[model samples]
Target: MMLSHYLIVSGILFSIGFLGVLLRKNTLVVLMSLELMLNAVNLLFVAFSRYNLSLDGSIFVFFSITVAAAEVAVGLAIVVALFRLKQTVFVDAFNEMKN
Candidate 1:
């Protein structure tokens, strides 16, 4: 119920997401981790907004969710295309994309 609680949880979520993005090789896991990180930021915005007694944070979260939805759609499509081309979801497999 306290601001500290929200901050701690948000920090944990962000850390986990950051590690997942850094240590995982799977593209899907990386994408999910990115989502986790984004959600953590959203939680912080909401907590601060509530603490400040304003609706701005919630409104920002709404738009953030909308953008995240669009990102997932496009990201998944790209992943699907990559899989079709390479037969694997591991990030390392796409190194040839540089060429």
Candidate 2:
């Protein structure tokens, strides 16, 4: 399709992901939402790359995916550790960290 179509889809995905991150209480869900947001950005990058007929955006997308993978690994590990300590993954339940 056209670049506009891709942009619209990416924007919608980003909005949904943003809302998910803002409204969810579970840390796991939040992490997933964050990934959703990242993917949306990746989608935009690829769309622009395709439109411009250049590899730069695709290269950026590759690196973004790599970084996102690392983030997921570290984020999940932290979530698991927090769950072990508190027996819950809800962000509200970890108010002890507020100090």
What ranges in model 2 sit over 4 Å off?
none
Q: How would you encode candidate 2's per-residue C-alpha lDDT over 1-99 as one tens digit per residue?
A: 789999999999999999999999999999999999999999999999999999999999999999999999999999999999999999999887589
- lDDT for each residue of candidate 1 in 50-83, tens digit (9 for 90 to 100): 9999999889999999999999999999999999
Residue pairs with colliding backbones in model 1 are none
Return the TM-score for each candidate structure. 0.94, 0.95
Winning candidate number (lDDT): 2
Best by TM-score: 2
lDDT of 2: 0.97
TM-score, cand. 2: 0.95
